[model samples]
Target chain A: MKFSINQKDLYNALNIVRRAVAKNQTLPILTGIFLKLKNNKLTLKSTDLELGIKYDLTVKAESDGAIVLPATQFLNIIRELPNEDVYLELNQDKWQLQIKCINSLFKINGYDPDEFPNLPQVEESAKFELPANKFKEMIKKVRISTSKDETQPALTGALFEVESEKVKMVSTNTYRLSFIEAPLKTSVNEKIAVIIPGTTLQELNNLLEDEGSVEVEVDSNYARFTFAGIEVISRLIEGKFPNYELVIPDESNSNFSADLSQLHGAVKRASLIAKLDANIITLEAANGLMEINSAEGSSGYAHEEVKIDLEGPDQKINIDAGYFIDVLKVLDSEEINIEMIGPLNPLVVNSQKDGDKFIYLIMPVRSQS
Target chain B: MKFSINQKDLYNALNIVRRAVAKNQTLPILTGIFLKLKNNKLTLKSTDLELGIKYDLTVKAESDGAIVLPATQFLNIIRELPNEDVYLELNQDKWQLQIKCINSLFKINGYDPDEFPNLPQVEESAKFELPANKFKEMIKKVRISTSKDETQPALTGALFEVESEKVKMVSTNTYRLSFIEAPLKTSVNEKIAVIIPGTTLQELNNLLEDEGSVEVEVDSNYARFTFAGIEVISRLIEGKFPNYELVIPDESNSNFSADLSQLHGAVKRASLIAKLDANIITLEAANGLMEINSAEGSSGYAHEEVKIDLEGPDQKINIDAGYFIDVLKVLDSEEINIEMIGPLNPLVVNSQKDGDKFIYLIMPVRSQS
Candidate 1:
């Protein structure tokens, strides 16, 4: 096979699919990017059994063939080449790929194209299109709460819940939970729910562009997302996601609001000391101010205070600093509202303005002995 | 001790001394930054036995005392604090430092100041001043050639030779050498030479600013560099440096010149393939073209062509691609001149302009069987 393409086009396409390249030693060909040139178009595909991505671009083709080359080496060479036309040719017998760009010519070894696994076929039983920005935002919010514990497979992924007029994403690690719902004006009679691995959402977030819509198609075993000529297919986790709504507090006896930036800065500084132990920081809200303090042991302690507008009653709770910081980072609002019932109740953070109903609940940690 | 200082000033001072903090499992005190407050000045010092640095800044002193705080924790806390006056108070009985910035307050555990080792002092036998930018540039060019091999302690440092009117820095790993000399106008009755550790040169390069001059003092066993309120003292390596002049060819049978950027890019691309083995690439200069080729093995090969102006006989040589890349990255000239005597002789690269004298000699690698 022989074809020539712009260096930038090839580099960008490689980057899109490289996220799915296998990082394990289970299959050698899974670490390679499968390239096929046919009908004046080039298709690049990468899969690691559980996740796969395919990117297509038009190129000047002199012949039609296929080959699988090492993903990292090929990407590095293409990225280093000057922004000009790069010519590629495949020698079928030797299974070698020749790449030429300006003054650089390289012949890279490759595996047989036939050995590379094909992406899993996804059937569109429940399909819908959502704004890429909103989808990306929802993924970012819920992804942080997914547990990294592999033993609990259901906790390692976020649940995608779709109703007739609204869509909601939820994730929980038992310690904290994130639930975000967005209005979807579409003609769908049935409800659909799928659990997507947290890692897959991370890759999707990285690849999704803000200016387009992502068409999502899901079956019982697989889910496919297509946007901007790039398609991603991810295997759905076969477990039941925890019911996050049951854990979120419906009402609170105390409500406190503070400037977002101030609260974020205070929490970050307190965490520097709190992380030395269990990373638990105590927050006391009363009167017109809130005090955040790190436990003072042999190491030291940190105390930060931010003014707040309190309503209902006074409250104090100890929560994981990292969980609070995560929500603060993802939030773009100037102010944030926190609701608490008592020292034992879960602290609830609700997103205000540009509202689509977002809530983050953090379970309070029991004071350590 | 009690004092108040601007956040930025404290952060900058920490950066300078933090370089000397021990990175290994050495004495615990060596990993802490020594802080002393006296007469309205705050001095920060750190030492890792081989190298030491001290930085001073002015602050509002409420009292005078000394303590050593954990280097990284203090630095991080100070870095994250808002850019305002930071108040520090020392509890001598507990060896704890209390830091307050804006609405945040932190009390960090620290080591007793008496336990921290003091920086060694060097006798002022020979001293000279050089432009900070020039010294930084010279350090950048020579330090890259220093060997990382711990067996040769002397080769892990650069020889600093200061004459009445010239200052030269030289470093080598036996296979490749870098020599850079700059014109100096200073009063020095005796010639002084010392081998400063490569790590010291790197830290100095990072700390030196472009605006002022650096005062250098060298004795038989130690060297001190002071500039911009920062002072660095490093122990000298005791051994004779190899005579690099013997390897640089005075007369060449082949002289070729080419666009620096083009040749650099071509060689970099070719090295991408050659590095899979012994990192060897061959340069064939003939007519008006230079051909760079990587050996074809199981991984495949790379070929790159660069236009050159040949003034003498054609030549061919094989050398370590990494050594060649080091010089290419340091050079700032638009055109690079390469002088080759024969296939067995070392290749010499001469600096182009600015009247500075610099030479890089790379020993040829024996051809692979």
Candidate 2:
């Protein structure tokens, strides 16, 4: 194959596909990206068995052929090349690639394209288009709470609940739960729930542009997203996502409101000390003031207080500072409302303006004292 | 003990001494910083047996006392505290520290100050001062070549040679050597040579300011540097340094000059491909052009040529791309002169201008082919 393309275009396309290429895979062929030049277009495909990505870009084709080259090495070479037209040609044996640009020329070894595994065929049963920025925001707000432990495979994925006009994304690791909702344009008559791996959602979010819209297609077993001449396909996690709505507290005996930034700052300050003691920080609310504290002997102690408008009884609770910080960072609200039921019960936090649609619940830890 | 100090001042002092505290040491006391309050000054000291640093800052002192607090925890607490005056007082048992600022209070456990190791005393033998920026520049240029292997302890330190009128610093890892020199203000009757650990030199450089000057004191077995209200003392490595001067080629049959930036760009681009093959890149100079090439099967090859003014025989040499990049990055010269005696001999690189006295010698790798 012989083709010439702009360095920037090729670099950008390769970057999108490079994310799916396994860094160290048992199968050597899985580490390469399949490059095909045909009909004045170059298509790059990479996969790690579970997920796959394909990027296509237009180029000036002199001939038509296919080759598999080391994904990382090829990307690195193109990334470093100056912004100019890059000429690529396949040798007679189809085992060598020659790339020339400006005053530079390179000869790289290529593997047999036939050795690459075939990409999974994506079948669309339901397709919907949503604003890319909105979808990305929903994923970011909930993905962090997904379980990292592989044993409970179900908790490693984000549960996507789709209705006729709205979609909700929820994720939890049994310690903290995050739920975010966005309006969707769909004609589905029945409720659709699917457990999508957090990693796949994260990659899909990264690939979407802020200004454009994304088209998502979902089936019983797989989901596919297409945008900007690139397609991503991921297998759906096969398990039941827990009923998160049941766990969210319906009402609380104590409720308080505080400036989000002020509370976030106090939590961050207290975390410096709490991080030494298993990331536990105690929040005490009494007399219209909330105090955050973490103490570890010989290490140090950190304490900060924030005045709040409250309609609740006095209470103190110990919770994971990291979990609280995660929810606080993602909530796009100036004021936040926190509901405390009991010292050892799950605490609920939600944006005052967002109301109950995007609720976050975090379980408290037993006080060490 | 009782005292009040600004949070910013305490944080700055803690940061400077934190560099001297070892992360993981068998002795627990070595992991903490000894804080002494006396005569309205707070002294923070940390030592790792080989190196010690002390920082003194003025603070409000109600009583004179000393305690050892965990270095990392104290630093973290001070870093996150609000910008305000903080009050610290010893508890009734004198083993706990109570800190208060505004409406927040924290109590942290502390170790007895007597358990902390004593810092080494600085001796009066050789003393001199140099521009902090110039000294930092010298260390930056040479320190990269210091050996990381512990088998040869002397090579892990930068060799400091002080003569009657000249001061020279050299570091080598057998494959590469960097040497820098500067004029001395203090004349010495006898030559003073010592190997100061590269890590200690790095810490001292970090503590130094670019526009100021630093006083350096060297004794028979140790070296001390004082600047920015901080004093650092490091034990000298006791061993003979390799004779690096003899390895640098005195004259060359082939010489080439090129723009430092252009050459660096070409090298870095080619290195992206070369790094896949153990960082080996070949440089071929013939007729007025220099070409760099690196290729690994299945990965790829990168080739780039730079125009140069050469007035010597044609030559080809293979070298580690990373080592070559290190030499160029540290030189800071606009124009670089590369001199080669032969394809297999060590290549010498130096500045084309006269103001900077720096030389880098890189040994060529024998190409497998």
Q: Pick the candidate with the highest DockQ.
A: 1
Tell me the DockQ of each model, to 2 decimals: 0.86, 0.61
Q: Candidate 2 docking category?
A: medium
**Tens-digit lDDT string for candidate 2 (B1-369):** 799999998888888898888778688788888899999988999999889999998899999888888787777777777789999888737577777877667777778998888888768778877778878888888888999999999999999998877778999999999888877555566788999898987886687779777788888888888877789989999999999878987889999998888788889988887776788889998989999888553466788898888988998999999999998787676788899988789888876333557888889998734
Per-residue C-alpha lDDT of model 1 across residues B280-329, encoded as one tens digit per residue: 99999998999999999778899999999998888999999999999999
Worst 10 residues of 1 chain B by lDDT: B350-359
Residue pairs clashing in model 2 are none
- Where does model 1 exceed 4 Å of error? A352-355
**What lDDT score is found at residue A100 in candidate 2?**
90
Compared with the true structure, the alpha-carbon lDDT of candidate 2 equals 0.84
Using all chains and alpha carbons, the TM-scores for the candidates as numbered come to 0.98, 0.94
